[model samples]
Target: MGRTSKIVTGGLLVCALVAISIPVGKEVVPGLFPQDQSSTVTTPAAQLPPAALSQVASVSELSPDAPLPDAAALSDQLKEALKYDGAGTVSVYVSDVLTGEELFSADGWTARTPASNQKLLTAGAALATLGPQTRFTTRAVTGSQPNQIVLQAGGDVMLGRDDSKPNEIMGHAGIATLAKKTAESLAGAPGPYTLAIDDTMFTGSTLNPYWPTEDVAAGEIAPIYPMALFGARYVAGELTGPRPHDAPVEVAEAFAVALERAGVETIGIITRSKTPEGATELGSVQSATVDEQTQYMMQWSDNYVAEVLGRMVARKLGEPVTNEGAVYAVRKSVRNLGLPMDTIWTVDNSGLSVSNRVSPAQLVQYLNILLKNPASSAGQELKGLPIAGLTGSLSDRYIEPPSWEAAGVVRAKTGTLNLVTALSGYVVNSDGRLLSFAMIGNGLTDGPAPLRTVFDNAATVLAKS
Candidate 1:
């Protein structure tokens, strides 16, 4: 058989084997080992919290038609693989998607800093609240003055500066196109007109106080604005750098330049104002669908995109478009999912804020919901996840043992910071049964390298189980 065939055949064989022997209530799954012998393994050091144990118990009574690997053996392996005697605490949660049973858990309810793993929640929240087909629009409307024009930001944070290059999202809808359309609409009635920018879609501070001072200065994050060119940076043509503090004003200036080149003249200083209610729209550019943008955010762990989507969610939910508003919106979205909101405490949509906290169990539960209905909006967001050793953030991972076996089998989200490391996603086990799992580490004095190894090895075990 070819490599693909072999893999498929092996997967089917394991599924068939497991499907044939159902275990009695609370009894060990039959056929894991000989009927007469038993195996022992280490238990996780951290005790499962009451909340997590309750969730586990909810699935304990499930009686699958097929047998599964010995829960004790899996638990032992996970315990051994996840044990890290470093400064930080570690949490692990794993569940069998087919049987709805908790296979292993340790401190699963303990909240920890998630790093980029927070994007998973943000992505889900956006899909749940904004719908899959939602798109942002940037518009040019008539200003209060006859010769003046208002460039209204419609939450297209990634809008391109010009029309030279095309992009799937913002770049496709170029500023130059809008400028040409605006000039045409004026019909030579304008020359050296003053321009203004409307950025009131978001109502609060651009910079989050919780964000580190150095990150803003170093360009790790730009001022979150609704209408900006190239994600708020000067990426016209080939140039890209940190965006100015007054990004919206700068974008208005650039739009003025584009208007002039398109036969419209602009004069005087550009200013900020709210677009009049009855203003006429000269031109508009739209972004890609929310689903595609979410995929991009998840694949690259883009902070700017995440923040933009968060604000979008806030707007959809009738909340202010600020850091606090984003948190409230996400909370509303999660609450609407019928999941408890106590597990999540977020200061900002992008996990860049160290103040964010989320539990391992919460992450796994969210994944389980998505897995239960892969066709649902929540499930569609999973398309953005990086595949182990194949694409996205995981492209460089799983190339070596003991993670090699999971190279193509594991699809997950990775999170890392100074001392935090997290991994959450799905794995098709050796039995071809899908599983949802999450692991997180905090206060890791040893850094993330060793914890990453532990997490990868744990994933490999699940894939090969």
Candidate 2:
């Protein structure tokens, strides 16, 4: 081509670049580009070349201006951002906390495994349906005789190690309370009486159906029998071992011994029993409110607690106590709030099974429902979540500056089991707007490494501009 034509083309190209500059900074594109010949970006104080090597200063006193991409504009584009890493599909949803604005989403409605994050749903379901003042009821019933009583399972997950005064037994002292109650009830029977328990809160499915049968028996995943009569041994923040097989029996023995120490003579055998018809109520204990329950469940990323909470959903909704029943019931609970919830598939309420899937969009919907319906039992439950960086799984997050309020200011639930890592929570952004977000990753080959920078960048963006 002719030199004159080349010069003319170059000038037009520069003009076109200037026009592009008007909207350049909308969304942060990739790295940097040259702003002028022989120099990068020029500023008021410094005169330099296209770039430098030492500290890599921006030469421009203006701190260098590439272009400003609208955060609100980029918000919608943030969904599936982790997809760039070529890992499993990642979905994100962020909303304005105050204005109810759905800032962004990518396949947000597409269901995906939520991992431990599912505990949030269980916790939320429990808190919303049940009141903060609500407590689980653990009761003692008499089936045959006064001295011969039945220690019935009443779905008390926090039942502790005592056996006296079943109604007000300290959670840790529950087993002992049971023992005490046994002694009091036997009150000098003619023959040696026995203590049998009825764990029928969940009848159809006794174990975590989603867990491998071998693993279900005693590992981190035990059969979620409706009898948390004894506290599950939570280790490394996960259920590592099952309570002894003779757990309840041991509790009965303690009660009997305590009574004998109190001068009551009795010989009895404590064992598991069937839930019989027309069982009578002898004494009982109450569970904490739904809010308190959620707090406990989420802070520790508990699975058994989630399972029990699922059972509670079944009980309250009058559904069957199977995995399917609980999922349907929870879905119904969400729908009852008048939100769209067709995109979720809850295989297990605890999210332990890879079969479980939830869309980032759906979580945001859940959050919106809660924010809009403050009087709602569910919203109240959401508030029970531990403060980020302060409680629950998020206590250690966002330890650095320039990071979003992912730690203390955010109240979110984290889900991680094996190769998956997830985060879902609420944050009040700098603009004083409430933002609900979900960051979920699956098939993380290097575990969660591929998604760390993505999460940090997103959080930084949300917190900054």
Report the number of the highest-lDDT candidate.
1
TM-score of 2: 0.73
Error of 2 at 29 (Å): 33
Give candidate 2 regions above 4 Å deviation: 1-86, 145-147, 163-173, 185-191, 212-218, 229-231, 234-269, 275-282, 401-406, 449-457
* Residue 53's lDDT in candidate 1: 21
lDDT scores of the candidates, listed in order: 0.73, 0.57
Q: Estimated TM-score per prediction?
A: 0.82, 0.73
RMSD of 2: 15.3
Number of the top-ranking candidate, with TM-score as the measure: 1
Question: Over 4 Å off in model 1, which ranges?
Answer: 1-67, 164-167, 236-241
